[model samples]
Target: MKRTPKTLLVLALVVVVGMAFRVSWNALRDVARAIGADHTAATLYPFVVDGLMALALVATLVLTADARRFALRVLGTYTGASLVLNYVHGLVPALHGASVDWGRLADWNPANWALVLLATSLPVGSIYFGSDLVAKVLHHQPTPAANAEKTVESVSNRSMADQGEPTPEPRVVNAVPIPRPVQVGFLKPTLPLKPMPAIEPVPARPASTVAADSVRTRRATGRVPDVARSTRPKRTPGELLQEARAASADWPDAHLTADRIRKTVHTSAEKARGLRDALIAERAA
Candidate 1:
């Protein structure tokens, strides 16, 4: 369906046909020898044609994983070389002792010259371009190695991940969910901005012991799990009190004491403001 697959299929067919012809030619040459006719010239033709086709087929397969730009270069090199060589020197050799007919070759124009050059040296060109493309693709660093390394390092990470040793579990915890303090119109206070910390998937084992389960690959809908983002820090007493005040604003009896305030306020912002006010008011008045 795709261009590469189609091209490969075509090349595969050509390789098979070319090889069949070569083998058939060998058998024909043996028959000619039995009859005592000069068959050496005919015998070599199939081998050359088949060898050239085989080179082209190999080049096409190599292009499958190569970059488009580079693959095109290699693909071009193979087709160009194979077609030329197979027609001229490869097929022409069958008539070795016969007079070289320049007029018959002229009917095909430059195709004759192309065949000669390709038979002699086009495959080396294919190898050069194909090798260059493959080398570049395999060495591409943008593709993350973490995914591949996951299989190798998974065993190593298992022990440290267990025993509550600060293992990276898929759960994100104790993260400040506030915007970073950025300069806007004025120096406005922002919720403490903490980065979305990296989370490791919690191994599906009991919290106490991690069973080395076989690595399983899963298909995901590409949503980050909430467990990977569910961390809230412990708020201070004053911070707690402010939250109570905000929630219980209408209740006049909301006291600033830890126990009373703890029951009253919630959220980081409310508690921080309430405690800051309470501490400063006592010092001033």
Candidate 2:
């Protein structure tokens, strides 16, 4: 069955703990034997709990890149699996051994069942999780906006007419007199068409234009007129500044505060007042 991370973790815990309990049971069995406690059955109970515990623990986690962790996991899995297998062999000695159990045999141990399940299951869990992880990692992204735009442009531009005009229907004209099927064979066909005019390539012009182009290219003109220099100087600087500022502020966020932009009349008045003040100061000096 397909196992998820949650299932694996739970199963691993169950297997590990169950295997540990089995190990304790094996010890108890040995002690019971020492005390002469009867464990008489169809076969001997297997005592391989250490191996099963290790296997369960290893299978629990082996996906990480850490080699040390991986090694430990591998060791644990091997030992645990061996314990589970050995326990099965011990419990059902008749299966491995030549003789059959004289009495009825228990199908399997509950603790052993848990160990076997976890020891083998971790790999399946890892594979399922790893496949999804790899797929997500290697997933391809969609075409970018620029690439999609280019494709759209190319697709939109393609035209059948651009390639060539459509083929016209073939015209078959029989002599107007032929109205019968058998008599049509003798009629001469007349195809109406305009004779195409023969084309002649154009002769090149005299080299004077080329010379004019070269002169245009070689001779640098005087400094072009500076658009910033105002011919109408009488129009004060404030008026020009606003116009210049408006033209210059062409970009998206271009703005100006209302209070700072006064009309040229106010600036001119201020300049006149300054001149008067300067004249008064000069007289006092």
Candidate 3:
């Protein structure tokens, strides 16, 4: 694939995001360890914080309206929490496994207690906020069964309206109607129909006389006469070919196509083709 400007920009974005996430992950992991999380807990702690942030970010993009606002709130909360933890890790070098005084925070100062509370509560908050965000997203999305039921209800309502029937109350359960055998009864006529008069049989005539009569009847009715019954004498193939040759003798070779020959000779397409080929061959000779 050709590398367009958009593709290049997206690649650059992905690279930057991956690098940023790696840096954040390391800082958050260190912060988790500093907050008294054990080895396994510290390792998984970053995922809880950073993973919730990532989920919120995706939800922000995928969701819209009120849902999107909720996702944005979740994303901002996690982002701020991660930043505070990372900042604390940087400020207190003692948290980075350095030989330093824990005696400063040991005095049970309210500010120090608040800081400790904030660090411990972040993981719990991540869990609560993440669950709520996921639930909100799921709630916005309509399930297939719900959609099917709505469709069924709408169709049933429309059909009832068209038939001029009173609309029924909506059913709580799936109301797909069962197929039942319909009994169709035929009604007998209340009064007998008038007896049809007997139709007289048409006397057959001789073929030649019948053809002449049909030709005359067509002419009287202003309809085109049938070819078989017309007064004009039918010409043989040889006669038609002779007439075509004479008629197109002075015409250009371009005008001597089968369609033109057929119109000029008033003959069948097959006969016209044969006549046109014969004329062309004669000219060549």
Candidate 4:
């Protein structure tokens, strides 16, 4: 059960205590009246007076904090017994024409004022204590508001304790949104393509110039320089004959004729003939 502040509980306790005092005082007065010589006591008077006293004492004991359950039982018995006894006593005396003197009641004193206060508070105190006792007996639970307050208090405590420690960073959940596909139709290009430009031909270099370039390239590349082409319209027979003879060394002796020399040397017939004759003379020598 959620604990409440002691204020209401204390108030209820005070009321019950006041009621108990009132009841005890009433019981003691009844016993004294029955015992005093001024009042002639009947045979059952002592027992009735003492019984009320006993009940009042028990009520006082039950009204205490630890004995709430018994309070209800004792209070019920006392109320029932007291109601019957007081009613009978008042009625019998009234029927005998012994009604209370109102003039005597008007004669006020400190004790009378006190009694009046006690009488007024008795029912109020009884009601408060009775309700509280019933709730306790029935195991009345705390309301949601009370529970909520308790929960808040507990949470605040936890937060205070956690304040001294490092707070963990909130977890970052990587929710990658899916890309929506675009729905587009294929469209033809509107721009026209231009025609390709025609390639122009370059003029050929002279044979002499080409030869010179080749000679220079050969020299630079560490290669034997080739024989330079003659500017003379007529070719050298000796030079052709020497080249043909050197080239024909790889051929059989029977293949070394004037026609083969002409084809191999790519020269005139006279030169080829002279070349072939030179080769034969060289073989004979």
The candidate that wins on lDDT is: 3
Q: By TM-score, how accurate is candidate 4? A: 0.22
TM-score for model 3? 0.45
lDDT of 1 by residue, 170-278 (tens): 9767977898776666766577756898998975766345333334455687889888975877777755545654654554433434445444443445554666466
C-alpha RMSD of each candidate structure in angstroms: 26.6, 18.6, 15.3, 35.8
Q: Could you tell me the TM-score of candidate 2?
A: 0.24
What overall lDDT goes with each candidate model?
0.51, 0.48, 0.79, 0.56
lDDT of 3: 0.79
How close to the true structure is residue 205 of candidate 1, measured as C-alpha lDDT? 65
Write model 3 residue lDDT over 177-265, tens digit each, in one string: 98997654566668876899999999989999978987874435565668747676899878887898899989998888999998887
- Report the poorest 10 consecutive residues by lDDT, candidate 1: 28-37
- Per candidate, the number of residue pairs that clash is 17, 7, 0, 0
| TM-scores of the candidates in the order shown | 0.28, 0.24, 0.45, 0.22
Best by TM-score: 3
Worst 10 residues of 4 by lDDT: 98-107
Give per-residue lDDT, candidate 3, residue 206.
94
Off-target runs (Cα >4 Å) in candidate 1 are: 1-72, 84-99, 102-104, 108-163, 167-285
**Candidate 2 Cα deviation (angstroms), residue 83:** 15
By TM-score, is 1 or 2 better?
1
lDDT of 2 by residue, 1-285 (tens): 556988999899989878776655553234223222245611132233343334434433432444335445555554555445445546654533434333222345575456445434534544553344344334524437779899888867989766577689999988588565666566776975568999999988779987887778556678867895666557555554545355434423222222222242234545544433433344458
